[model samples]
Target: MYRLLAVDDDPAVCRALFDYFSSRGFFVATALSAGEALRLSQTPPPFDCAVVDVLLPDQSGLKLCQAIKETGAAVVFLSALGSEDDRVQGFLSGGDDYLCKPYSLAELEQRVLARIRARQGTRAQQVLRFGPVCIRLDRRQVEVEGRPLELTCSEFDILVFLAQHRDAPYTQDAIYRAIWNQPGLDGTHTVQVHVAQLRKKLAAALPEHSLIQTVWGKGYRFSPPPTA
Candidate 1:
């Protein structure tokens, strides 16, 4: 069964969503604020999709969406702010879809399912192998030489992104935007830091092969050994 999280400050809306989705076979959870949603997100078996309101009691839902994206869950923003800029900001903050308030619960369900389906489609190749490194998309796992390699969510995402586009050099700004789904407002320093950490981990596992290559004047690329 698909796991769904619905976040809205209105108890009525939350109850409605819970009832609507639950009746349709979704395992639904509801939260009234961003903090509560974050707390619930920590539970095992991560949610497949989150329906979040743009305006939250404690924090902006855009920020919440970023945090949820790091967990590899699809996010849909539901808001009364229906302007173009609002929708743009939602997408920039890693939201997979944006729906205006007073939305049809049916439409919301369709949007949520669509986003989850899109994500699943992208991960259709369940396992990706690059020499001694193996990525299991379904399980969100990485193994090096048949031994499990622990990687933070961001690191695993970066690895998969690079591996999918093997040999193509992407600038730090590009990589940051691709992974975070936001413009590099504070520069690409965060991407640099994550890449550095990821490289260090991979180096420790594969001493001889350099799977990720940094291109001077460019950015980075996944260049596994040819024999793999």
Candidate 2:
């Protein structure tokens, strides 16, 4: 059975999907508001897929979708507003599928299942493997020599940013803005520091592998050396 999170303000909607999905071999969890949905996501063994109503009492479902997608969860937006722009915005907000209200619960189940399979396929692609080091973005797991390796919050976020944009150049200011969420605000040479710390950790883990490449004049790139 797959884990499912269903969020909607209407009690009937939430209970209906919850009961239906649960009957369809799914362990479903229902939340009346976006805040409840987020709280549920914080626990271990993250939800494989989330069915969220666009109109929530607390927060926007699209925002929840974006937040959970960063952790590798598939999102399906459920809303009454069915327009071209609404659907487009849902997709742009990281929703895998958008379903209009007055829709079939059976169809929602199928869409959720399809999203789960799609997420499985996409997760493999998001992983970064360099020799014995493996970074699983979906799970936020960093492994060395097939074992989990603990990393600082800053180190993990920065490393993932570089890997996702491999072969690209990013100055300290850009990285700071991306990781620190301080857009257009530059401070000290912080990128220089965390990069070195990441390098040191990598060196200690995989002595034979070179994962990060320094582009002189530019910032840096994540280029894992080819295996011999």
Candidate 3:
């Protein structure tokens, strides 16, 4: 099982993440502050991945992230502050990914899984191919029927998530959680809007309508190509 170290001051957040990821077949250890994280990172075997809050009680998460990077662990920043500058700082601090606050556990799981897959080298097939659409994991590139799809960062992320789990029915709320990473925004209509955009762009590129299908009260699923 993969091991993850999570650093956050909020006990509730830490507990939620620890339980959520653990239930998903991960060995997760929680740290309530930067000091605890730093101390844990120095131990033998270390941790395979880390989820860090941008703020900590003892020190800044950026600093903690930097320290964790030195340990050669994959770093993901989870912050309440979602500024471009903040994200840039996360990357500069050696973090591989950045997630804003109020994030959904599903989205967090997706990002964490991606990082874990990357670290596993040959075991991680980061690319997903459906019909003519191909998504390259490392380069973060997407192409449909040989034509590149110009998608915003979040759009691409959502598509990648759906494509990877094609045909699996998921709710709009669940999709929002996976894509936007905003948990409390459950009843919000943001997910529908993004899905519409995703479908429009993908449909224009691909020769298919069932690429993304709504399952009525359930959510969306990536439909397979019809047999010729």
Candidate 4:
């Protein structure tokens, strides 16, 4: 009996998700706006999963996904924009998965269920360090100069992946396949946005080090500093 949250401005989509996922044994709840969804999560038992639409009346679902990702709920982005960059933005925003609009209901259910199961997977023990930044995988905490930094789940995961494979260059497609665990990921730039977000946080945390660098046509690589 997993609790689910569905957010969309369209009444028809809202009803459809509610009715369909409910039949699938999810205790589904609905919200028409980002603010409404945030408010709903403020009070009670948090949702296990969220199905969010990118185009919403109040705010972009990307921002909403970042807001609630730390709650440990799986998020799947639903959007009409099907471009590579658009899908990348959805993934970069900390969503566990992305489904373009005009998608089949069956496919959506499969994605949503997969995301939920992925979130429920076991936690790994890993600690990565670069300068003053420290990432504790067991607790999923990121700290810089002994201070904590707020990062979305996707951002944290991307940084961990790069750090674990220091000096290794991975094309966007390769990184996307590894992180999303999907074969032959279609969206080209889907991995770039997440890397960019991680770099931004690293910049703020460790100004002296570039941390991740572009490899021209090769892709991106993690640059770790000399160990003391």
Compare the candidates by lDDT and give the number of the best one: 1
Model 4: per-residue Cα lDDT at residue 28: 71
lDDT of each: 0.84, 0.79, 0.78, 0.78
- lDDT accuracy of residue 131 in candidate 3: 62
Q: Candidate 4 on 94-213: residue-level lDDT in tens?
A: 999999888888899888877876776534335667777788876889998899988887677667767766656777775664455354557467677777888888898888888888
Question: Which tens-of-lDDT digit does each residue in 1-228 have in candidate 1?
Answer: 467889999999899998998888676879999999998786544678999999999999999998888877899999999999999999998999999977998999999988987987754667888777889976889999999988997898888878866756878876665556444275488988999899899889887988889889988889876663
- Candidate 2 Cα outliers beyond 4 Å, as residue runs: 122-228
lDDT by residue for model 3 (132-200), tens: 767887678888778888887767766766765674677777666555544467744777788788888
What's the CA RMSD for each of the models?
Answer: 11.8, 11.1, 13.1, 16.5
TM-score of 3: 0.53
For model 3, the superposed segments whose C-alpha errors exceed 4 Å read 122-228
Displacement of the residue 150 alpha carbon in candidate 3, Å = 48
Error of 2 at 216 (Å): 48
**What TM-score against the true fold does each predicted structure earn?**
0.55, 0.54, 0.53, 0.53
Assess the local accuracy of residue 73 in candidate 1 as a C-alpha lDDT between 0 and 100.
86
Minimal lDDT window, size 10, model 3: 174-183
Estimate, for each residue in 1-228, the C-alpha lDDT of model 2 and write its tens digit: 357888899999888886787667566778998888888776433568999999998999999888777757789999998999999999998899999988998888889878987877755656878767788875778998898877787788778777766757777776765566444566346777888898898778877766777788877778765766
